[model samples]
Target: MLGTLHAWQAVERGHDVVQLEREPEARGASVRNFGLVWVGGRAPGVELRTALRARRLWERIGERVPALGFRANGSLTVARTEAELAVAAEAAEAAEAGTERGYRLLDAAETKKLNPALQGDFRGALWCERDAAVEPRTAQPALREELAKTGRYAWRPGREVCHLTGTGVVDDRGERHDGDLVLFCTGAWTGGLVRELAGEPPVRKVRLQMAQTEPLAEKLTTSVADGDSFRYYPAYRGEALDALEKSQPQTETARAHRMQLLLVQRLDGSLTIGDTHEYDEPFAFDVTEDPYDHLESVAGALLGHPLPRIRRRWAGVYAQTTDPGRIVHRARVAGNAWLVTGPGGRGMTCAPAIAEDTAEELDL
Candidate 1:
């Protein structure tokens, strides 16, 4: 969305941008998502303005591009367990600290009023009244076309990045394409590239599994989530910081042990739910139709509806790092080349703004 939305921004700045991806179509972690452009679970003093701006950009894109499942109807996060409830309350306190952003706590009754399908008993939830989501599978292709329509940008697909140069990207087949500014935007394929470029942006690949259920005929709006979901988002770990750290220690076993259920009812009425974490060093496109059974068990306990049947399931990997929320560093190997990754699960929430940040970082 960022490349297409702001390619003009760079073009207008006299920067020649060349967009490249290894897939035949726009497919990757960025495309396969819950398509939730979220900010509610994110903490205070981080990316509020950026997300707000991205919200604005998404709205504008909906005008010209395919209808992104962009629902400004807001989001609700419930808390069933005591641990979950406590975290929600603490998050509200923290969100309120950043008075400029649009967020508040909703009692269980109020939350149910917003999303009847979100039938759960809890203390309450942190509601980001301005947050929204889009159907990524559709939005990504629309974005590709949107960018291609503009002669200012050249987008090449089915191209693999062999290495990064000061000027542009050289594909695996010994093809070099130059651009005024080059941004390495591959999702999880970045770890090796960053290493090869020697920028060593302190990134790794985290794989998550998600599933889609059969469509429900009724409308289920208001992006529904839970406090346990907040545990995964590093932003909301305030007093729950201990729980977050202890819940998912830095270990392969911890990763296998930890999973967060983020269930959102898409516009089509089918629910998109997921996910568990496992970071693999050299990432592979390892997809599993059946995710660990316990993820579904936890999800079943959290949701208003039981997952009767799963229509689709797949694994997605995105760049993650402890260094920062995101990275747009100049390659240590080649200053002209840049490494852009580490979106974590916030790709849908933060991609547009991060893309804008990419342009800003390069003065594109």
Candidate 2:
């Protein structure tokens, strides 16, 4: 997404851009995410601004690339407890502190009206009408195809950059690709040439496990999240959240694994659910089924029905900054080369705006 955004921005400005990929196609964090353009969950300042800008950019780009499967279905963070409902109330009142996120505190009846499928026991939900989604499995390819039509963009797959040459890169094949300005948006991969050039720019890797279920017979209407998400996202932090934390601490297993339940329906009507965050290095080689089991229990409770049979499960890793407050770690690797990475889970939501910031700053 970063590469495609940069290439799209440069090509729109009438500059030629080339993107090099190490694999036949992107098969990393970019593709393995929920493809959520979440707005209400962002912290109130530059992060929110970037997310709002990116949200607009996504709609514009989606218009050009219909295959991206952009949908303005919005989101519902269901609040099962009174404390959770209090946090939602606070968020609804403070919506103007950031962008116009269209936040509304929905009672159980109204929540059901917005999403009829959520016919379960819940006090209310925090509705963010600006939240949206895309098809993660196909978004990159769709963007690349659209960029190819610009005639000023080139994509070189199966080219692993083995070394940096100041104004260009040398691939493993010993071929040199030169450019006036080079941007390395290398996702979670911080080894090899990146290590030799940047030497770990305050970024850490995070591993998560996620799964997809078989298609449901009904529509979810909007993306859904359990109240446990309040602990993971910054937007819900404050007195209400702190009180909730004190009163309703996460389960021992959930806290140990840093678990959160975010559920989003895919274009095919299947649900993509996850995940547990593991920040420690030397991540386990295998994913555990305990987290999946816990997720099913929580999701079933909210839906008041059994989930469809699980069809697939996988684990992924992405880079995040060691600094909790930083959005991404952008650094200059050479006179003409720059590295932009470590947007954490915000990568899918803020890539376009992040790339736009890069282009504007470097005058690309």
Best of the candidates, TM-score: 2
* Residue pairs of candidate 2 with colliding backbone atoms: none
Model 2 global lDDT (CA atoms, 0 to 1): 0.89
Candidate 1: tens digits of C-alpha lDDT, residues 1-364: 4344445456646566677777777667776678887766554455556667777877776777655656677777767655666666676676353454466777778877776665645667667677777887787766666666667668777877877666777897788998656666656664466566654566667777778888755456677675557767655767675774565343342245456667677767887887777765554566553354654655555455466577888877777655663332233246676556666777677777776776776666
Candidate 1 lands at a TM-score of 0.82
Evaluated at residue 260, the lDDT of candidate 1 is 63
User: Against the hidden reference, what TM-scores do the models get?
Assistant: 0.82, 0.97
Range of the 10 consecutive residues with the lowest summed lDDT in candidate 1 = 324-333
Count residue pairs with overlapping backbones in model 1. Answer: 0
lDDT (0 to 1) per candidate: 0.65, 0.89
